[model samples]
Target: MATANGKLLTVPEVLAELGGEVARSTFYEWRAKNQAPKCIKLPNGEIRVRRSEFDRWLESRTEEAA
Candidate 1:
């Protein structure tokens, strides 16, 4: 999990960062499997992901072309 002090992105923002191709349901599924970037749940149950952590996560999933 990342620190909360960093910029926090909402689920929609995250999706847009992913090019607006991934559905919300699919993202939720990734969370359930713990395959997505670490997220923070606020007191009001809103989900947020740190910008740095999200960038790291995207890098982790990248595959170099052969």
Candidate 2:
């Protein structure tokens, strides 16, 4: 299920978008370390990442080959 533009993405959706390159545990680890993209914590305690922010974060990760 593709996330619509500007929609908020769940952990699983973000993982799928990364092609499963990173494990779910690693994602959580990143969150804990504040290394992942900014996320929203819903009132119920669920975490969500905005599509636009995720896209920006992903783009920022791009590094020119040495």
Candidate 3:
């Protein structure tokens, strides 16, 4: 489903869409450690990570790795 601004992505989807090979469980682990991107928890208990936020996170990681 598209968000208010036409974004349609989940955490794993965002990671894959960005060409990140992170595993689903690993992503959850990162989230547990507060090391993942910013996110929103909906009333249905679903986690949603914004595409823009993930992009920024990926860019930051790339810069850090450089």
Best by lDDT: 1
lDDT (Cα, tens digit) per residue for candidate 2, span 10-31:
9988899999898999999999
Candidate 3 lDDT: 0.76
In model 3, how many backbone clashes occur?
0
The local lDDT score (0 to 100) that residue 66 gets in candidate 1 is 100
Ranked by TM-score from best down, the candidates are: 1, 2, 3
Error of 2 at 33 (Å): 1.2
Candidates 1 and 2: which is better by TM-score?
1
CA lDDT, every prediction?
A: 0.92, 0.89, 0.76
Cα lDDT tens digits for candidate 1, 1-66: 346567889999999999999999999999999998999899999999999989999999999999
Reference-based TM-score, model 3: 0.73
lDDT tens string, model 3, 1-66? 667754657866866775787778887898899888887888997788877777778688774434
At residue 44, give the lDDT of candidate 1: 94
Question: Which residue window of length 10 is worst by lDDT in model 3?
Answer: 57-66
Model 3 spans > 4 angstroms off: 4-8, 18-20, 64-66
